[model samples]
Target: MTTLIRYRDDAPQQALESSTDGAVIIERLAALGVGFERWSTSRSPLPAAASADAILAAYAAEIARLREQGGYTTADVVRLTPDHPEREALRGKFIEEHTHSEDEVRFFVEGGGAFYLHIGDSVYQLLCERGDLLRVPANARHWFDMGPRPRFTAIRLFTDPAGWVGHFTGDGLSARFPRYGEPYAGA
Candidate 1:
């Protein structure tokens, strides 16, 4: 299920708002200049272990639309499994707060992850599941958590030829909030 929990940056112990409803999620994220939508996953027969080429082909239409709409030039698929040798290292790289020079767009084909966006005075914890397409605006302060046993296949779109790159915030605010799969207990 896809979920969105909005909390005050200084008050991580309590959620200002939370919902699993797609419409609500979309509206909430859109208000923050972040795009969120559910794409139909049945466009092609995509297995959990689908290849990048296969995954790209499965959503070519949607990809084209996003490319036109967002001026995105390239798209790729990234899959990380529990058995991946560098899962821990990769997860660690993204769990810290960071920002990209270009928009960070992703379509979740399988499994899930969480994107913590620190915008203004609020931190929106967006849990993206299968079929969820989330577009975090360029230069948005955020970080991602793929969990300890990451098992997700995501299609990523990039406007830059160099693709995904993060600029760490060095604020260490991410550590103050609940991580992926952790129970949200407010202080």
Candidate 2:
């Protein structure tokens, strides 16, 4: 399931709005120039791949469709488990508000994560679980939190094959926002 929670950046403890409905999620994100969609895979659990090339090859058709639709040039899988030693570093890297030159797109294959987008006067906290696909437009102000116990498998589509490069905004607003942790409604 996917959840969208809206809040005033300064009042993160209280949600202005929240929903588990997919249509509503898409509509709300779309209004912010972001894209949200649900996708299905032929298999229940995607095949395990040790390398980016293997992962890309495992989902070639899906990658091709995304590439055609978004002009993405690269596709890769990122799997992080709770025991990963670098989880803290990776989480810290994205905890600060930042923007990318190209759109940041991710498809969650398993587990989940959250993307907090700061647009205008509100902060949109999007909790994405399995089967969820989210695309944050180029230059969108946002930060991602994989939580303290990181566990997720995501397929990322990049406009540049070189992959993720973020420009920090130097604003420490992320700490004011709620971190990812609560289980999706009904899990």
Candidate 3:
């Protein structure tokens, strides 16, 4: 299920609005100029089903398709775990605001996280669970925060591998959004 939660920048303890409804999530995100969707279980991609060469081939094909459909140039796929030491490091590294030349595409396959997009003065914070995806456009400043122990994996589709590169934004706009942790449904 996909989730969306809104909170004042300083009040992460309680969400002003939270929902697991896909329609609501999409509508809210769309309002901020962010694109989001849910994929059917039938369309799930399994890397293990193919040989190494075949996997690469499939990945290439998928990349091309996404590029054509979403105007993206490159992509990154990652499997995240709460135990990953780099998780904290990556979080620390991204504390500053930033933007990409192309949209930021991410599909959660295992775990969930909050992607906060700072569009104009409003902040759109999306909680992306498994099977949920989000595409934030070029020059959209934002930041992401995952749980303390993410049992999650995600596929990140991008428009430009290089253009997707981050340009550090000196502003503290990121401080306007929430920091994420904990389960959305049970905890």
| Collision count for each candidate, in order | 1, 0, 8
Which candidate tops TM-score? 1
Better of 1 and 2 by TM-score: 1
Model 3, 1-187: lDDT tens digits are 4667666555444556677788888888888788788865443455533343442343465557667998765555677666787877766665567888877887665567777766654455676776776887888888877755655566677655765577888877565444565432211
Cα RMSD to the true fold for all candidates: 1.6, 2.9, 4.0
Query: What are the Cα lDDT values of the candidates?
Result: 0.89, 0.85, 0.66
Over the stretch 92-176, how does candidate 2's per-residue lDDT look in tens digits? 9988999999999998878899999999988888988988989999999999999998998888999885756999999898987
Write one digit per residue (lDDT tens) for candidate 1, span 110-187: 889999999999999998889999999999999999999998889999988685689998989898888888878542
Tell me the lDDT of model 3 at 119. 63
TM-score of candidate 2 relative to the true fold: 0.90
Reference-based TM-score of each model: 0.95, 0.90, 0.75
Q: After superposition, how far is residue 79 of candidate 1 from its true place, in Å?
A: 0.4
- Order the candidate numbers by TM-score, best to worst: 1, 2, 3
Number of colliding residue pairs in model 3: 8
Candidate 1 off by > 4 Å: none
Residue 117 error, candidate 2, Å: 0.6
Compared with the true structure, the alpha-carbon lDDT of candidate 3 equals: 0.66
